[model samples]
Target: MTDPVHIVCPHCEAVNRLARERLNDTPVCGKCAKELFVGAPIDVNTARFNKHIERNDIPVLVDFWAEWCGPCKMMAPAYLQAARRLEPRVRLLKVDTEHLQDLAARYNIRSIPTLALFRNGREVARQPGAMDVNGIVSWVDALMRHA
Candidate 1:
């Protein structure tokens, strides 16, 4: 990697600049000393969601879901699996639409399980519905290739 990338901490939302090669070293935040990428979906509200989308140099994959949505619950494990497979390159997140209705409205998220990929503070691709791990991986991979 030529230049360090900005990574927003999942635990504290503090920004950290790290070399791309160090992403696999279980890097910790400079400010909070918390592990940067934990290989799981971090549930976020509007503030945390804005920090991640606005700060991260890497692509961010967001799962916009609600608590009472049965399909969202069904796809939780698959989203986790996708996180494990996609992290160090992608930042995976979950936003409860019910809790952050403003964010849902801002993104125009009409469905419970919508996957939106953001790069450099702009949405690049979006998919609405529940998906298995393979489906998530392939969809992201295809979008990344074109990005």
Candidate 2:
């Protein structure tokens, strides 16, 4: 039997086991009938953010931003584009700094737009500033390679 790998369903928050070979392919959740990797940023509140970080076996790239921040607005589309490209390899997540002030404070996020990469529920890298699609992809690729 192949070793089981844990993956959290972005649609329904259900944890499921999948073979390592299936990581690059399309994955469907047994409970929710949704694709496990949808190539979109998943909006997560404080509680759900903690849960996802703790439970997911894949690397998570979280965008910490606010609704009113100009830089955040400018980078939104780029972030989404990067998410679409990086799907199945990295789980993209978004945390609204306005709604989750405590979380923002916990992470010591003083900037309006910050990107943090987490693996195994630990922060491996972070950057502050708005990045274009190419920049985002390059950053993640570099980080993952180094990791």
TM per model? 0.97, 0.95
For 70-99, candidate 1 gives per-residue lDDT tens digits of 999999999999999999899999999999
Q: Which residue pairs come into collision in candidate 2?
A: none
The local lDDT score (0 to 100) that residue 65 gets in candidate 2 is 97
Assess each prediction's global lDDT (C-alpha) against the native: 0.95, 0.91
**What does the lDDT come to for candidate 2?**
0.91
List residue ranges in candidate 1 displaced over 4 A. Answer: none
Lowest summed lDDT over 10 consecutive residues: which window, candidate 2? 1-10
Q: Count the backbone clashes (under 3 Å) in each candidate.
A: 0, 0
Best by lDDT: 1
Error in Å for residue 50 of model 2:
1.1
